[model samples]
Structure formats: C-alpha cells, structure tokens
Target: MRTLILALSALALAGSAAFADPIADRQAIMKANGKAVGAIAPMVKGEKPFDAAVVLDALKTLSEDAQKIDVAALFPEGTDKGDTEASPKIWEDMAGFQAKVEKFRADTAAAVAAAPADLDALKVEFGKVAANCGGCHETFRIKKS
Candidate 1:
C-alpha cells in the first residue's frame, strides 16, 4: 500500500509538471481576465441591465486574476516560442513590460475598490481596467491570429 501510494503521488506530480508550460499558463491567466471583463462589459455598456452582485463578482475575479499574474516569471527565457503571443520586446524592455503589468494590477484593484453600485459608475471603473489591459496588450502582446 505504501509503495502504491508513493507511485500514485509521483505520477500525479509528474503529470502536472509535464503540462507546466509558462507561456500557456500566462495565456490562461490573461484569458481568465478577459472572461471577467466579458461578464460585466454588457452591463457597463447598458446593453444588459446592471446587477450589483454580478458586477461585484466580476470585479472580484479581475482583482484575483491580477494578483495571480507574475509577468516576469511567466516570461522566462526561451518561452517566446510555441504559441506564445508575447513579444520579444518584453525581454528586451522588461522594465516597461513590468510597469504595464503593475498598472493592470493597480487598475484592477482600483476597480474593485470603486465598487460601482450602478451601470454608470461601473462603466467608468470598467473603462479604467480596460485601458490598462489595452496598454499592456499594445506594448507587450502580439496578435498571432
């Protein structure tokens, strides 16, 4: 039984490590951030009726995702290949890239703090968060498609 348990644990760890791709990890994180924005954007745009709870949840998601992002570590050496959308300039201009990432984190946190109670307020707060995302994408990300 002990040997079996040890073997299972080793297999699990190895399986996870085998799928650990930094570029994919970062992309997944960014996709999560996008999903959060998508969830609330319609309400902010007045296309869908505002729901305070949903807005709060979306903001929370953004904040959580921002906190999880480690831009520097995610873009390690030789991670620029494969399906990565990250620009090579990210390594060359690391300071600028990190600054943009920090701005996105700050903006997401500010959006959470703003805690818009209505659509109008939510629009304003969401705009700030969106701008931060756009800034980072424009500077550091390349659209492969």
Candidate 2:
C-alpha cells in the first residue's frame, strides 16, 4: 500500500508538471524578460557603471525570449483562462498580435547586434525594445488591477 501510494503520488506530480498550462509557461517567460530588464536597467540609468557583459547577457536573453514565445501555440483556445491577463482580442486580432511579436523579435535582434558601446548608446536601442513591449501590452494585454 505504501509503495502504491508513493507511485501514484509521483505519477500525479509528473503528470501535472508535464502538462503544465501554456498560460503559465508564457507568464514565466515574460517574468524572465522583466528580470533581464531589471538587471540591465540600473546600468542603463547610470546608477551602476555600465558592464558590457551584463548588458549583452540581458539583450541576448530578451532576443531569445522574444523569438521563443510562440503566440499561436501558447494562446490556443481558452488559454485565457485562470489568472492570465491575455486579452480576448489576441485571438480576435491574431494578425496584429503576430505583427507586434515579430516587431519585438526584430528590435531585440537589432539591439543585440548593435552591442551598445555605452549607456547613452544602450539607451536608444533599449528604448526601441521597450517600445515594442509597451505597444503589445497596450493593445493585447489586459491590465489587472
């Protein structure tokens, strides 16, 4: 009985993780973006002396995440369930959503390639990356109070 219970518990845990909701997965990805931004923001603001390596890591993370987030797969029917802040309009206007995603991907890639030499240079490239995030949030993301 004890062995059976342990086996069942392990299976349940594995199943839950294996089938983790896409909404949660995407939310985690966005959270990672925020973390990367947080790491770079201080240096960009001149609070911390600019570290080229840190900046590159942040930009690389942003670029990778932007490319990996598959909207079509993650936002499938009813993925808007639970605590997700995804707007219904994402499905309604997928073309626009995809455009925004592509823009972000391009902006991040450009920023990565430019490899800003200093805080001032990083600011301009970062602004474009930030704008892409803001533009999508303004239209496709629902604000949660």
Give the top-scoring candidate (lDDT).
2
- Write model 1 residue lDDT over 1-145, tens digit each, in one string: 9999999999999999877889878888889888888889888777889998998998899888888778756888889888988899899898888887788889888988988998888888899999888888888889987
For residues 11-108, write the lDDT of model 2, one tens digit per residue: 99999877878898899889999998998888877789998889989999999999888987788889877899999989899989999999999999
Local error of candidate 1 at residue 102 (angstroms): 1.0
In terms of TM-score, the best-performing candidate is: 1
Q: Rate the local accuracy (lDDT) of all candidates.
A: 0.86, 0.90
Taking all chains together, each candidate's TM-score versus the true structure is: 0.85, 0.84
